[model samples]
Target: MKSLETKAKEELRKAKSDIFSLEYQNKKVWVKKARGTFSSALHKFYYKVFPFEVLIPVETKTGKETIAFETAKLDLFREKGILSPKVLFKNDEFFILEDCGKNVNSYIRKRDITQEKMYYYLNLLIVQLALIHNNGLFHGGAQARNFTYKEGVIYAIDLEDSFTNIPLEVLQFRDVLLFLLSLTKTRASFDLDYNYIIEKYIELTNKKELKQSLKKLANKISFLIYLSQIKLINSFLGRDVKGFFKLFIILKKL
Candidate 1:
């Protein structure tokens, strides 16, 4: 019988997608490959033009460097007591992670899940995000899609974003905004009380600068908020703009 490492290597050679799942040791694991050079470059460029002080983009890497960076981030998150996927196997070309479970987005869209249960899961996510920020760390992509839920615990995944050369408070503030924005994309957003969610986060987080950052961001985007209310602009931009307007209105009150 071939070792799991050997099987993984063989699978990698035949793999077409950058990320996929494989069975190993009678359990499912996920394999991730580095982005191509062009894709990595474009990622860097997108961040370069991002119009916020909170998102200070770093140089993006590809191939072996990308794999190494992500692996290091996973290890760091574990060290900080944040729940993340355990790296079962890794190398320059690719790495494999123990299966966590379905993302919160899927749960939000499930028709059978009660509103109370959905709120419970959302609270878990918010608490976990608070814990991560309180630990002097920030999730670069703190979206619902990047989080997994299993056995009543939410695990943060997609730990590829780098927080280098950025203020910790700024990065953490960005994480909060990204998380709230992601919730707007879900069907449950309509039923959610934006004020309650924001207040809960404020109550849990010890970051004194967070409210200040929120105030600053709200002022900076006041024009965008006004435009988002316009029927013409809202139609073109969709629910995202409306969601932002709603969330920022609550933030502005803080």
Candidate 2:
């Protein structure tokens, strides 16, 4: 096989192609250009060491545009003992992460897919989330897509809006909201069999606690908190922004 450097260079070139390519995971990823300054020499240097990159994520892990941010989430994943792609490179402008393949969203949406397999993947995700929360780190983005499954393993991805800073609530909301978006963005309108999702989510979590948490979350916010909360709930239910905004506007009209 080619030397590791040669392999990475080959990978980097692939990363730079098109808006981006999804060769890292199954349809997982590495990363491409920084949004604004990538064309600049200094920004490239700066992003080289950044921890995560803002992205235009698509059917693959990355998207047409991306921005890099510096953080220790890579190490956090390693330290917390979560399954993830390794971060092989970093700079002010970009950081290279291991490729996790097509996410659980696709798998879950595949219809009539086995519950045993889905639960197996979800169990991994829940365990990882529990561990991260215990350590004061938040996934910031948790959803089916952020995880990749191959053979029988799961890998977590995306962390541009992430933080280890927390009362745990911050992390919780971020992960919950983003995951909902992953479903919203990736699946079709009719693709979501929401009750099925709730069944799965409930399987991995304590339904009583989740219900109580939702009540608490809404109570602490404005009277319209239910609407905002629905943003996440609908997303998990596979309802997209198009549908969500329409519903939000209707509720506001009410």
> All candidates' TM-scores?
0.86, 0.54
Best by lDDT: 1
- lDDT tens string, model 2, 1-254? 45434444566665635224434323344653433312335444554644212221211122222333322566667767876767665554455665666677787655555656555665665665555555666665676766777667777666544232245654564465455445444333243333344344555444435444433433433344355457566455434545444333332332
lDDT of each: 0.79, 0.50
Off by over 4 Å in 2: 1-29, 35-71, 163-166, 180-210, 216-254
Clashing pairs in 1: none
Clashes of 1: 0
Work out candidate 2's RMSD over C-alphas: 9.9
Per-residue lDDT tens digits for candidate 1, residues 134-155, read 8887887888889999998999
Q: What TM-score does structure 1 among the candidates reach?
A: 0.86
For candidate 2, the TM-score is 0.54
True lDDT of residue 190, candidate 1:
47
